[model samples]
Target: MLINVPENVVPDALRGFAAVHTDLTVDVERRVIVRRGAPYDGQVGLVSGGGSGHEPLHGGFVGRGMLTAACPGEVFTSPVPDQMVRAAAAVDSGAGVLFIVKNYTGDVLNFDMAAELAEDEGVQVAKVLVNDDVAVTDSLYTAGRRGTGATLFVEKLAGAAADEGAPLDRVAGIARRVNEASRSFGVALSACSTPAKGGPTFDLPEGELELGVGIHGEPGRERRAMMTSGEIADVSVDAVVDDLQPDAPVLLLVNGMGATPLLELYGFAAEVHRAMGARKVSVARTLVGNYVTSLDMAGASVTICQADEELLRLWDAPVSTPALRWGC
Candidate 1:
């Protein structure tokens, strides 16, 4: 089957999604630029966004403990600085705002521009660029590699730091540490995220998988014959474990790309857990969900971060975001 989704339609529908969430509200004319009131006095606010296709991300993360505002753009496209500028202004309390941007080129460029624009308005701005996906490590084509599942970890941790009245630089520094210590690896079975692009993002007949897959349906690092779910989990997670140190305990994120259902995600997580135990690794905290995704890719990824004391503390703090809320 084939489908061609209209450009403006999805963004329009997302406006309603924004309205329904108490922690978020959409600026219809601006697409999914949802706002959440700041949580404290004189506390630096967090504002983050990118394209809307990766839902419950920048927008879903808006709340008292997370982002104050999110500037969502069209599907798979970066938001303009103007939208971010608007969000920055709205969410700015007396302190400042920190922008959590993925390391993609368009995202990096636009967010950096927005920070500069916000500075001109006398808003103290800091940024933490996330690039934890080990899939595409080359910096030649894109700006290094794409930011993947670990963003959720960064968001919650940073939000916690901000909630406790940490300065912009300190919050951003912790976010950077999360991004640095973490690593992700994934495998894709089928793809179809954009509603218009109905069928799989790419044509993958039965008995094949793309390893090291990306969120935008881009090519992966390896294409191989299909394997069992347990094997798939082992292979994907092994790549991440290989890069991590043996002594450190990790904060784990087992994420379904999108189309992968919870039934399968649970099984995958179990496999990843089993694999870690076999290596005598300890898990400090864990998250499993559709964190960063293509429209609907039938796959899952494993993210492992060797957590430090500060990072773990921040992760345990209160957060009140739309997609995730706890503690406070």
Candidate 2:
């Protein structure tokens, strides 16, 4: 409800975000953000993009051992092919580029167009479409599952592979594997108000919540009466676990949907952990914070990625990004 501006919010916010990171370079003209000295010359490049408001996703992820560049569009709007083309070119190190595309129709079409354009420019390009959200099989904006938290997994795992000098195809394959093994479900306590919309995207009356909501503030599978935190935790974890059908150790990511406070996130994470234990699910790794977010939406999502020895090794690899930094 309280953004700095009523228009041009994305560019204005990007200026501030770029100013804070010395390792990042913002190409205002192209609306592309890249990590300094990325692509590492001969290493396969990783590039991804989507609507703007999901901060710290594609943007914060641009750094060593992660993404080479990220293209951000206006809030909830997909970046154009030109933006992706430029970003891919900047990060291509003679080793080709891999575009980590979310399954949203706009994102898929734009990234596909960019890939073709880049190929014409003599750059080898590959794509891995992410559709790991278990919220809905089809939505108003997408034909399949809406990509959600698993986009982070795909970027990190695939980026680590690329940073290790894996070829474009291999990196894309890793991204696909991560997506196939991950599932996510979200619950929204309140709707988000975008600067452009100037009001809540959707209305959630008091004493009610939307279960299995999308990150773009889209209506979820169903609406339910608001329950206790522990009860909400049960529902969220149950949905993901049922869909994932994990047979091995798991990586649990409890993510906040932007405006939720840290205090509440941590509390919710604890409840989720307990729920997993009751189900005899083994959680080998855990991340609790706001990673993939829907701007200022007061809700949380639980993402469970089936992790094996190989996935665990990649997950533990060093990564340094603005929103997530570790093993560096």
Candidate 3:
């Protein structure tokens, strides 16, 4: 919000992001971010995109063990079908392409249309819809559950499977299973300000919290007096566990909503660990950071994925992206 750029803020930001990550090549014209070496023969290409505000998401995630290409649209706006079509064409090998779409009305609609466009060019396209947020269903913008933190799990698990040369159907199935086993809940201390909007998306009085807040600043399940960090973690864990009934081993993601500092994120992670311990849930793997975030929103979200051996193995697989890198 404090930065200044030309009129085309999204494109300008993309140029800077591309400069820092040489492995990620940005098509300034198409607004698509592609991995340097992609479209591996017999491997399913993974393409995902959405609004631009949530960085280190669709774009920063473009690399090996993750997305093949990511097409970013204007802030909070769905990418046009052209971007997806071109990305699919560029990344699709004989094994086909997979579209990891979050469950939002505009995203679903546009991605579905893009699939049809790609099919016209003889590219086999499959899709996995992520609606893992256990917040208010059928929110103001989405038809059903709004996709949130759990999207990262789907991308990693499915991307690992795809990188292993799994066919489109197999990759889609893996992503679907991940989605089915995950749940998320969020709490917001304040709202985010988009460059275009020039103001916070929503308002919150001092010492108040919005529970189950969506990534796009949509109204949450409820608003109440602010609770301590520990209390917030307990409530968030309870909501996700109640929905998930997680297996013995669970993958936990304590995500900061953009503006939330890492110190606070780690603090919340500790609280979540204690809360899950009290509930008899085993924390198999933990990721604490801002993987999925709302723009400059002072908040955090918790995502839990019930992990089996297969899921854990896939999760531990090598991934090299700008925002997330490990085991590479």
| Number of the top lDDT candidate | 3
TM-score of every prediction relative to native:
0.93, 0.97, 0.97
lDDT of each: 0.79, 0.89, 0.89
Residue 90 shift from truth in candidate 2, angstroms? 0.3
Per-residue lDDT for 292-320 in model 2, tens only? 99999999999989988988998999999
Q: State the TM-score for model 2.
A: 0.97
- Model 1 scores a C-alpha lDDT of 0.79
Q: Weakest 10 consecutive residues, lDDT, candidate 2?
A: 133-142
Q: Which lDDT tens digits does candidate 1 get at residues 1-328?
A: 2233475655665656755775566777865454555435778878888876777777778776667777787777788999888887777786888888987888999999989999999888889888878877566775687788878888888888888888888888888988888888978888654655644567776788899987777768788999988898778777887876647789999988788899988888888888888778888888888878777778888998888788888788787766777777
Candidate with better lDDT, 2 vs 3? 3
lDDT of 2: 0.89
Please say which candidate is ahead in lDDT: 1 or 3: 3
Clashes of 2: 0
Q: 141, model 2: CA deviation in Å?
A: 12
